[model samples]
Target: MTILPDFRYIRPANVDEAVAALAGKPGAAIIAGATDLLPNLRRGLGEPSVLIDVSAVPALALVEETADGLRIGAGVKLAELALHPVVQRDFPVIVEGALAVAGPTHRAAATVGGNLCQDTRCHFYNQSEWWRSGNEYCLKYEGDRCHVAPKTARCFATYRGDLAPALMVLGAEAEVAGPKGRRKLPLAELFQDDGAAHLKLAADEVLVAVTVPNSAKGLVGSYAKIRIRDAIDFPLVGVAAALKRDGDKIGQIRVAITGSNPCPLPISTDGLEGQPWNEATARSLADRLNKTAKFQTTTTVGMRYRRRVLLASARRLVDDLWEKAV
Candidate 1:
């Protein structure tokens, strides 16, 4: 049986305490819902000397409605977000994405922050310590080269988070706290293209909350993904789209993709606004999605197959959302 390494546990009462606990500890990691972190720890993927529990931070568990939009605490459970009446009514896309996350049991314990900040995955990297040691490890951890693309000095692990794509499509902002104090930035800016260092957050920074803009409310949106299993498997490719229709023509639209690249990416919808919602336009959108998606041999699925499915999924989602729009 795989055993977790020993670590010191610290339960912080508030965000300040959490940040303080993590500030100078290079081997410290924040844990809200251990759904992702625990499994990785068991696999010997992380060697955190300290695990800071932030689940009891009351401010991080709130789901508040502001005049601008909604403020979702990072510690809020996925199940709670999926069932919240306001979220269900105004942001069904988020509900869909949250519900698509593992099974009900995982969602019951997984937090919004944990989902958004989950690690990147690759077939070669997520293995037992013995398995990885024999395989010479990958670039993501204590390794010299990326097994997926050894010719390049970059890791191609895919970010498989379901909520990030949905949130990105809605133009959400992330609130973060650190030794330097608190700050808010566009959620898209929180991630980079490199799998080894995907999140832009510093070791001491804590993701506090996420706020969706009021302008994104009332937009017809949908989230779809292809996963190996219906219940617990991570998505191979996920697509999210939000549309604003103006008399049968597209007024505005945003598309975001995950499980394809190191970070969730928004597909450019330029030249798509004011266009008729028809097959031709859908094809154009698909073409754009295919171009934007950068698939690699990260998951067990073939790269080409993932690319094709990403396009098809994006096309289908856009067409369906358009048809549903008033």
Candidate 2:
């Protein structure tokens, strides 16, 4: 491992203090668990003058259950999230995603906020700087072209955050603290489609918490992830779904697909609502899965293979939901 570049470190006493520190310093970066940021800094991907530690901030580290939903603190570690009983019970898809993110050692140190707001990644972009330069740079890095979509002006890098799809399906909202004040937005709105700019979060803002609504509503939830290794690897394609069943009928369904864009794609098309929970609806979903999935050959897998597997992932989730309802 390479040594991190020289930078001043600042730890605040609270969220307000942290915000002040960030606002006062324009080039400062927030650090929670430092599992991902440290490595990126060492590799020169981020060169902030000050590293503002937000772990000391009380509100940023809290996990509470409100009347509306479960609130997960941004600074809560992934290991803690995986071990939380409520997370496992109410949001099994989230636990499923968090449990497999990296190994136990890495998860022990990686924060939930870091994972949700994690950096966008690509096979070529994550490599060593020297390696990237040799390839003449891709759209995500020093290069002018997107290797995956040469003709397209946008970066085709993949968003590998395991929990995003699940959270999207769960209808999560994020509370962000900034110099202006704190505000909440739907978690899905926080992400931009461009791989080069994964988050809409500002440099001076820190994601404080995520609110997950509670409603089983005869719904069966499932998440499917495909990675090279069992853990510590990013998903090539991930599909998370929540299907509400009314007797044998499908009352409502929300499907989110990740690993295609800089952020997960939440398929909000109608017709899935109040449909028969029969084989026909399941088959129809499989067909629509292919049409909405916009994938490129940006990772280890081939573009065609990735596209096909997305369908498989979607079908499997839908099938699992259907079987559970039965």
Candidate 3:
């Protein structure tokens, strides 16, 4: 067995304790579930001296409904949230997304916050430390150039999270606890389009919760992911398309795709804001934007194959939504 690194583990009972523990420790890794972090450690990819465990913070695990919307605690396990009736009834997009994530074995241990803020992955980066170093470091690590795109000055790694795209379509907000205090911001605000960094969240901050908006006037939302297997596989390309219709005309729409870029690629559909949910309208918008999306060969499939599947996935979403309305 590969020997694990030596580290000091600190379990914080509350958010304050967690943030305080991380106040000035640049080398401290925030632990929630440890589903993603531990594996990297064992492979010698990441080695933090201090592990600040946030799993025991009760406030982070609490979720409840509110007058404005639902407050989903950061620590809520994916499996628990997938089975919640409220999630099924009110936010089927979220439920469906959760159900389609990783697998039952992982969902039970992985968390909502961790899923949203998971590290970006690539074919060249996720390997035994020795193996990756043997290939020379990629743009994501402390490397000189990208193995995927040697001429490009920036990283080409992809963000493969499933929940953030779903949440973005639902207008979700993330509540973060940091050394400064607690605050909530639009979920989309957390992500940075740059793959090298990927997010703007401070290292000391612990994402505490995510809240979904309550706009029941005319709600119709859907999430669809294209992956290699029926289960236990990350999506090669995922799309979360949510739209509100007034009578038969679309009032608002959010189109976001995961497994395509460093962050959720917000498909521009402003022209469809007041149009009906028609195949022609959806296809037109998709056609204009689909080709513009840059898909690198870092995912489970090649760039040509991934891009083709993404277009087909977008069409399938519109067709499925139309079928439901009938």
- Give Cα-based local distance difference scores for all models: 0.93, 0.81, 0.82
TM-score of 3: 0.95
lDDT of 3 by residue, 1-326 (tens): 24789889999998899899988888888888888888878877667889998899998887688886888888999988888878788888888888888888889988998898888888888888777778887778757888888998988788888888888888888889897788899888898877788887898988989988787324567888988997778889888877665667767777788998888767777688778777778677678557547788886688888888888887788667655644
The prediction achieving the highest TM-score against the true structure is 1
Per-model TM-score on C-alpha atoms: 0.98, 0.93, 0.95
Q: 23-98, model 1: which lDDT tens digit per residue?
A: 7899999998999999999999998999999999999999999986899999999999999999999999999999
- Top candidate on lDDT is 1
N/CA/C clash count, model 1: 0
1 or 3, greater by TM-score:
1
Query: Which runs of model 1 end up more than 4 angstroms from their true locations?
Result: none
Residue 20 in model 2: lDDT: 84
lDDT of 2 at 29: 85
* lDDT computed for candidate 3: 0.82
Lowest lDDT 10-residue stretch of candidate 3? 213-222
lDDT of residue 235 for candidate 1: 94
Clashing pairs in 3: none
